[model samples]
Target: MSNENVAILMSTYNGEKYLEEQVKSIISQDYTDWHLYIRDDGSTDSTVNLIKKIARDNEKITFLNENKPKNLGVTGSFMDLLANTKAQYYMFSDQDDYWMEDKISATLRKMQASEIDHMPICVHSNLTVVDTNLHGDSLMNSSEEHWSDFKSMLFANCVTGCTMMINQELKNLLDFDKVKSNKLYVHDWWIALVAAAFGKVVYLDRSTILYRQHQGNVIGSNKKTTLFNKNEPFNGRVIRMVKITSDFWQAYGSKLTGQNKNYVKNYASLVQHRNPLWNLRIVLKYPPARATTTGNLVFGSIVVRDYQKLSRLG
Candidate 1:
């Protein structure tokens, strides 16, 4: 185990085009106490070769699974890195994004300030949405004031992985075995849920990175689903939400607070009831918190109208 205070975990797959630039950004960070761990997820391109070359010149960088690259997808690759690395603080990185020079120092400062003795803590920040050419657009932040709450996190995730930092206590609570069995939506959402339930979630209102948007991005800012889209049905998104929530409950429901446990239990039970009225009743009685009143209403209406379809999807 390296004595570095922070471990920067990055997973790349066919990211040869922008990988070098991202690595350079990490190397240029003002905080030099961090170590970079890069895992190539079975890339057929020259991404692996590029990483090897970069790691050779930089002692701070470590190429993980260098001999055996596996296609574990984004979530799996990140979890794999998390399971193997030991550090006081951990941050996830995307191969295509550009981190600000002060990204690590700023996030670490916030984490240290908020951390308690052996209690889980996660610190996340806003992102500056940018194009492939690094042109900045609007800042991306959570619209929901209570986004760190368990109920809000269960339904909608505003935490972006690239802008997140977690303390060692929070990292220790992450169970890779449960992660393998459950239908998790993403690694970031799971971390948020654990932090919200067992410890504290701190939000930094400032942008820490240039969140690059491009065609190859697995999940980009522009690709997010809006509450209202004429062509897209709301059922798909709601169904995914139910699946993720149910999986989360099954994985960690026992440790949740009494109120949160009931909230998740009732929400997860909606798919079990055959009658739309019954499902609607449950949804009405225990609605998940949303950013706005309109959003809450829309989400409830979708569950009521498409209960059968949502159930089937689940």
Candidate 2:
């Protein structure tokens, strides 16, 4: 591989158990022209010490914010990393996942083969779900390679940060300083939405990382069943969808193109409008924003005030 620089941005809290293994995987990559930039968010455990040990042995691994570490959550920590790091390509890493040896090289190759000059591009691949002990679990299916429509991106976020790689062009365009902590949910979802709107998103069919599923995960793999009661009536997903779209418009409305801005506005109205049935009306009038037919049907069930119907789709 060429000597082009790639930055691996990782956030660690009290991840003493799997942190060392995750860092080792990065060191074992086939492509060696990469720097690991890690930030510890007020970890009182041995996580910081482990990172320091690695840093002492390897010059490429830099521990960020050793003096006065801030207690930003996962999303905030990643946002800080994105703002400060400088690289030709960037990849996000979790404190627990074990990446395949060729993960970086494969993603970089796909990114390079795309038309770099025309638009910013992001490449993400499927992941193999694994248990806490790194035993092989199940394969995660890949979504469609491209999501050009802003409306579809608004309702669902299929992109996982651990499997994502982005060009510097897309990185430069994000206004990280202006990002409101309260409005944003996940850093990867925000990046995916922006990339889908202003750039290109490519999905490689192959699995690139072993996504470890444990009890402490902030967000679990899609294949994992929801921790909540299966028959629960209160629809948190609907509420979250409303908030995410609304927050995105509040944060990035001015940055979006006119067409994308309109799509955001239309989706926002479906959630925020005073009329309770406005969502159903929009679903009937506008083309379906969701990608899957089942997804559209489930969304329509929510719009038509049928929570039981939506739950049955599970």
Candidate 3:
């Protein structure tokens, strides 16, 4: 871990409120062989100035696209950072979250121990959810079963970008063009999907960062949401999944193994085909999106309703 070099990629918009705290936390990290690269997404506030102030004093902290900044959303900004940076290992960071002192060192150690030679590897850990004041709200435990299957990953994302670290092999495999065309939900999910399919996805049980939840976040953790909305319609989600799945197949299907390719095709069919039996068959063949049995059961029950709607249409 001491010999390895890491590049931390962060995307910022109107993050002036918590940006300084986050930057200071990274500077205070116990691991010292890392550089921070931050890209601002056409911020109207003083976010750019704040990041520029930090970069002026530190050689390792780089402010990207300062002269001609483009308003590429959060996903696009991160993708831009990913395309340009090179390092032995890469990490994604949010502009507002404060990391634990040993976060990088701990995750890097885990990656080194579990890494397979010549294969893309990624390691991510649990995060402690906190409020704007940095008060510990709750814990989002990601210590469940390994989510390595393509079918499971197609439906849900278990890895969060702020807590993720990827090796050079994975970095080389990233296709920026495909992500830009596919309208990927986020950079982290795409990376997680690739790691699950092509290499190893390691999950560390310990919480390593203070994940701040606020109104300005692009995505927020929902620890307090109700279990299931029985009346919620699946039509909108199904439509979005169809487009995403088609785009994904067009982009990365050639790199997938025979087994994974078959699973993705079948899963895509289950969503697109109006046949109830195909849905039932797919449900029986592939495990649910969630890893636990009870979680899978609950997931299946909701899908059953959607399949019933398809049956009625047919």
Best by lDDT: 1
Prediction-by-prediction clash tally: 0, 0, 0
Q: Compare candidates 1 and 2 on lDDT and give the better one.
A: 1
Structure candidate 2, residue pairs in collision:
none
lDDT of 3 by residue, 1-314 (tens): 45689999999989999999999999999999999999998899999999899999899999978887998787778888889888989999998999999999999999899876778988988889999988985778634533656666676667788999999898777877656722566677778778878888888888899999999887775342112223334354443444455556766788777867876666556545665656657756775454467655645554555764433322
The alpha-carbon lDDT assigned to residue 76 of candidate 1 equals 83
Q: Which 10-residue span in candidate 3 carries the lowest summed lDDT?
A: 224-233
Off by over 4 Å in 3: 224-241, 269-287, 291-314
lDDT of 2 by residue, 1-314 (tens): 57679999999998899988999999999999999999999898998998889888999999987776898888888888888899999999999999999999999988888845657888888899889998985776635433545666676666788999998888876877676753478888788888888888888878999999999786676442121214444355655565677767776787877667876766566544545466666655554564356655556566567433322332
Candidate with the greatest TM-score versus the true structure: 1
Locate the minimum summed-lDDT window of 10 residues in model 1. Answer: 222-231
What is the Cα-based lDDT of residue 243 in candidate 2? 64
Note each model's CA RMSD in angstroms.
2.8, 4.8, 4.0
Order the numbered candidates by lDDT, best leading.
Answer: 1, 2, 3
What TM-score do all the candidates reach, one by one? 0.91, 0.86, 0.84
lDDT of each: 0.81, 0.77, 0.76
Candidate 1 Cα errors over 4 Å, as ranges? 1-4, 142-146, 223-233, 291-294, 312-314
